[model samples]
Target: YLASEPGGRHVRLRKKGKTASLTFKVGRGAHREEREVKLSPKQFAALWPGTAGRRLRKLRYEIPWRNLMIEIDVYRGKHSGLVVAEVEFPDLATCREFKPPRWFGREVTSQNRYSNVRLANE
Candidate 1:
């Protein structure tokens, strides 16, 4: 589940099988800062109903790459058939210096339409 708080912050309640967390995030793209709190099943259940936003479900695969990790997300449910790959860098300089593999496809990092919040609404 997802919600927007004041000042454009995002709150996300996520569950993966038996594990869950409530996350708060500010900013966007590579500049975002996130904080997560672990949640038990009971806590998740109580908070689930209060959460409001489009729900998103995806299977993420982490692959080790040259000094970085490539995260591939295969979306499910309403957003099925959409696949996206992302990589995180230590800083803006590193991010700018990086080149994508041939199989990485088009880059959409700067596209707001490709953002998770927008994708969920689609």
Candidate 2:
């Protein structure tokens, strides 16, 4: 997903193995949806086993404002000090519309900066 802030939001079509998803802001912890995936860890891995990287897990906090939702990730482990807030948009054109808070760090979408798959092996 692309990263962005207030003026609007950055957007990207995420590319994954056989599964790609589009997720965006809703309410608060507010957005809602439904889905059914049938796969145990074993089965899941067998289908699309992921990569290895530094493992990091955190509590995600979503704060809503106007038409945007700021997502904060409080990470644990090697990347512990790192906290990132992201706003997903519909396209790059729209991303230019917003202003991100100063606290936000570099945009890391393509880097897989927060992928747990990479985390597990780091």
Candidate 3:
């Protein structure tokens, strides 16, 4: 799944400690649960130095499906305007494929720019 928007803003509810995370969309949509991994700034730099011509941005959308919420991401830089959606499935093949909304660009699931860890630095 994929989508593109003019833009949207969200307030992040955050907590810090081991495995830091933030929550968004409050009562609606799946909670934006994120856990920070243990990685050095040097290690993170090696992965994404903000000059790789790719950046990651994510949007958590509310879905009216079976206990599900959609996570859509828009890539920046060389991969600008690209969109992809990730929906958790009970089975690997449980997901069905369909054409994205007209606003969406292309699907780049195989692209390396979709990773959030890389996006954090880029």
Candidate 4:
């Protein structure tokens, strides 16, 4: 639950099934850029000791919705029963103009509590 220093980068070590990766994120909100590097389990294990952050587990489903692809996440473990859907746009204009389907519940893009990092900590 450490905060990212002002203008500093945010990094995370993630393991999904047999795949492991180290992700570096810069910027904030909807404008952030992320870069990921694949890692071996042994490498991940070595890095895990020094990494500071919560781990999250979820099942992701990608479905085509209109002109955009919607990513639905079904959380597991402590956060079970939580389902969230997200859509990425090419630009802010497209994002602002996009609309959600009936199945999509309330929008939480601006809600910090629903963010993956926050959810991991919760």
Candidate 5:
């Protein structure tokens, strides 16, 4: 990421339709902590230009599957045609027991290449 620190901690500004937010993340991998704060349109416009090379756009859809929710992201712009589905778990045991549908392809859980920060890199 263009403004990311040495570690996994980073701050990101996201614009979803007419809404905007600022997200702060800490730690790395699957156990990271995150917090988001909504931003005004004016605030977003002021901060957006500074994030020129570090941006990506995607339309996310949440699908309810049994007891879990699957998040599907349809990437745009530089990563056009890229689609990913993710399921969040509260603990490691749950993640281990989850079974993906046949439609799912190879898993890239720990791969650095598929990470959002890398995808957004210019």
Candidate 6:
């Protein structure tokens, strides 16, 4: 789920297969800056409890499209039917120039209701 760190950073701890990462993001929309750090399992466990009721589970798949990559999340547990896709751009220019495939569905960028944290609570 999406959590906010101190100093107004958007934070989330992601477990991809066997690896875990702590990612910090700043700004909003297409120009956000992000940094990710590999976390030890113990470190992940220590911080995970804070998420408590906000936790969500998903299976993520990354697909290549031109120079950009598309990440699709297939949710699990109670939210099993929900699916979401995300693409991060290097800049606004790249974001504007990109075209989605016919099947990509509607854009939900910056929508609070679509965020994992919000969906988790429902």
Best by lDDT: 1
Q: Give the TM-score of candidate 5.
A: 0.85
Worst 10 residues of 1 by lDDT: 1-10
Residues 15-118 of candidate 2 have per-residue lDDT tens digits of 23455433342222112232324445455454332322322456678888557788887777776877767776655565667777777787665455354334
- Model 3 TM-score on a 0 to 1 scale: 0.36
- Model 2 stretches astray by more than 4 angstroms: 1-55, 102-121
Q: Of the pair 4 and 6, which is ahead by lDDT? A: 6
lDDT of 1 by residue, 69-99 (tens): 9999999988899999999888889898899
Per-residue C-alpha lDDT of model 3 across residues 58-79, encoded as one tens digit per residue: 4445454545555565555545
- Point out where model 3 deviates above 4 Å: 1-59, 65-68, 73-84, 96-104
Every candidate's lDDT? 0.84, 0.49, 0.40, 0.78, 0.83, 0.79
lDDT of 5 by residue, 1-122 (tens): 32677588888888878999988988666667878899999999888897888888899999999788999999999899989888887777878888998887788768768878778874
Q: After superposition, how far is residue 64 of candidate 1 from its true place, in Å?
A: 1.0
Q: Indicate the residue-level lDDT of 43 in model 6.
A: 89
Clashing pairs in 4: none
Question: Model 4 segments beyond 4 Å from truth?
Answer: 1-9, 50-53
Worst 10 residues of 4 by lDDT: 1-10
Note each model's CA RMSD in angstroms: 2.0, 10.7, 12.5, 2.8, 1.9, 2.5
Candidate 6 clash pair list: none
Which stretch of 10 consecutive residues in model 3 shows the poorest summed lDDT?
Answer: 1-10
What does candidate 4's lDDT look like per residue over 14-85, in tens digits? 787899888887866666777889999899888886645476789999998777999999999889999999
